[model samples]
Target: MSVSGHLATITSAEENAFIFDSVANGNNAWFGLSDAETEGTFTWVTGELLDYTNWFTGEPNNDAILGEDFGEFKADGFWNDLPSAAKASYLVEYSTSVPTPPGIMLLMIALTCLILQRKRIIFKTE
Candidate 1:
């Protein structure tokens, strides 16, 4: 997975294991075959196709012109089910889990340096 132009490619079994755990427990359904039970039509979070026919009766009937249109993906070109255009959230799961970004490591390194530097200051003050 990537964030703010940084990429973290998941290329290991341990990482995939974590992704599976996250998706299994996460509230948002971002990965794996839909429990509705079908194969080969595996819908991706990044994909535009939503199975409207499988929607619950009266579902996916969202109005197109009302500006609250989230179900118009079946007929209208409007963005559906995704958050607003300005949002930068990531879908962290699929059939397998994705990777956390490298920036988190950088942040940890910076925090560690700051903490160690504080220790140096205390030593000098004492």
Candidate 2:
């Protein structure tokens, strides 16, 4: 499915954390949140319920006169609503995969090797 189709499913804190960490690296980026159809009722582009939101303090104020209907992740990892025409990078979420850190992968490999070695030693003694 497209990112818009899956964006509403970002219901977990881990998913939110990953998105914030990935997109908020000293730069602002757009996401799927929007209220283009009806102000104050933010929804995903795919029409899914925007059940998970991390808006910054005093945000989603719809304070712009031209209509601020799109959501963006600021450089500080806070969320803010912006005009759709605003030029900024956007974030697209894929439901099929979760990004794993290199350090975690290395630790898993090391643990696996240690367990296999211990098994081999036990078998030899028996």
Candidate 3:
């Protein structure tokens, strides 16, 4: 199946630490950074501005021999560029627009009141 959602891009040290500690501690995963579009510049899948990066030293070396272009989160929490064919776990994020609980409750109350008023009108007419 095709996966959706933007890749996780580290914007700050805190974010990096959190992701490293929580997600990257023991697993290698595919993150959002990639130079597949351009040679040197990396961009997140979300299309957000490239405000932060945490590349390991000498990473994204774009080793022409290896043909590394996709970003990978190593077990050490540092990032490196690997070939797109590299096998690794991946993370997917989703954004949803949903009504708040309060809003749902208010809508329910309004519907109840409208139903009661309609019943009363029907009874009077009968």
Clashes of each: 1, 0, 0
lDDT of each: 0.37, 0.76, 0.82
Q: Which stretches of candidate 3 lie over 4 Å from their true place?
A: 1-4, 99-126
Q: Comparing 2 and 3 by TM-score, which wins?
A: 3
Residues 6-73, candidate 2: write the lDDT tens digits: 33334556766876676557778888787888878887777666677788999988966868998887
List model 1 lDDT by residue over 1-126, tens digit each: 433421122234454345435532432222221212222232433443544322334543333343332211212211233222323223343244467669988998999999999999999999
Candidates in descending TM-score order = 3, 2, 1
Rate residue 33 of model 3 by lDDT: 83
lDDT of 3 by residue, 6-113 (tens): 677777778778888887768989988888888888888878788777789998798888889998888888888999888999765656665568889999999999
| Higher-scoring candidate on TM-score, 1 or 2 | 2
TM-score of 1: 0.23
- Cα misplacement distance, residue 126 of candidate 3 (Å): 46
User: What pairs collide in candidate 3?
Assistant: none
Give the worst 10-residue stretch by lDDT in candidate 2: 1-10
Off by over 4 Å in 2: 1-9, 95-126
Best by lDDT: 3
Top candidate, metric TM-score:
3
Higher-TM-score candidate of 1 and 3: 3
